[model samples]
Target: MTTNPTLVLGGTGKTGRRVAHRLADLDVPVRLGSRAGTPPFDWTDPAGWDPVLAGVGAVYLTYQPDLAAPGGAEVVAAFARRAAAHDVRRIVLLSGRGEPEAEHAEAAVRAAGVPCTVLRASWFQQNFSESHLVDPVRAGVVALPVGDVPEPFVDADDIADVAVAALSGDGHAGQLYELTGPRALTFAEAVAGIAAATGRDVRFTTVTTEAYAARLAAEGVPNAVAGLLTYLFTEVLDGRNAHVADGVEQVLGRPARDFAGYAAATAVTGVWKP
Candidate 1:
């Protein structure tokens, strides 16, 4: 039988995947909580959840899509209740900074009668390196609705480190870490960094939110996802999240990773090449 296992939701996604790897490296038994796991866990299917939560002691909850979406808070609350019923002791929730809806979800986790830590993160640097923006970088141009508003894009590695620390170690409960890179940069500046590192000529183009949404729709992205992206760029990416936070240092006792470092390292992998 599996030992005292820590369940990692969204276990194949950006941060959760890294967290899982870090935990496994530390020789911790981990239960990957996703639709593809042994006992599948699907957010859309409540029946699929209990099986994964069974016998789990700790949880690293990374909500799919985002916690700011409709019904996200409720879903998290319900999941936390089930986790508590299953005797899970700790929960490390991956959250978004400056998102009111995300705050609601955090509160639900905190009130779940279990030890909870919220890793409230800004935009992820991996969003460019490993995500949708990778193609745009490889294509030599990244088009978005964001303007001069700078974002302190956090590295997913830093997020994963913090998450693993919280999930496996003590003294992290009831903490909320706002993880971000050490510097803030605009999309244009971020592209410039990637270009410098990869020896590529990547460009950034700004557009209206409507135009960005229209572009996503044309790409066959679901209307909800397209709208969420547009809302994130237009509403969340505003100057509200421009400043850098020390939550990473507060949690990890070290400075957060910088964006240039991420760019330099990812550049060596040739992931941005055309």
Candidate 2:
């Protein structure tokens, strides 16, 4: 590993935090890049990025909101350029699977002339336990605009492990890892698994995109956030990435964790308790 610390952007977020912890466990020095971090790294404030990149060997680059958001490609491109200018050894990006905008961002990262590894990950299993679905799951009903389309929800821990390996080890440069779970499950099936694990009565229901959008607007959700959810459900959740990918096993030499495993393990934390 390089003598310089690895800079983890979005360090307080789901995957970023996990990556930072894994790096620390491996005795790889880590520099967190967040608004609350030392020197404070904010994507909106590129002028303040230099301090965070100083002496950094590698970067775990994840954009806030999402790389699919508007202007994200430009921001990532600028940041990548800065990283290259600093002579950073590697960049491991946390990207969404089957999103065109994310592809643009990936292209921008590669264009920067830095050694880059892209982890194009499927939907996260943690979405049920740690994201907007948690409240609905606890309330016994998880409704969304998605139908029976199956998704291979990747574990955040797996993503972090692959990221740490790329950041600290070699042979990962210029690679694009399509990370997903071992199998695909529909939303209803996933909820059923969670219910079984927690002994709860959680159920999944499907709503029209219009109804979901109206609900979000009524609940005071910002347009951008509501729009992102709509895009994911309507555009990205159309069976395009339903198949499983071998990135996890290819990178970590172990099979990806199954959804049932994630649900069972998360149940022990009482995060889904009503």
Per-model TM-score versus the true fold: 0.97, 0.98
Model 1: lDDT equals 0.90
Best by lDDT: 2
Q: So what's the TM-score on candidate 2?
A: 0.98
Q: Please, what's the RMSD in Å of model 2?
A: 0.8
- Model 2 steric clash pairs: none
**Candidate 1: where is the Cα deviation over 4 Å?**
none
Q: List the residue pairs that clash in candidate 1.
A: none
Q: Give per-residue CA lDDT, model 1, range 140-206, as digits (tens).
A: 9899998899999999999999999899888989888888899999999999999999887899999
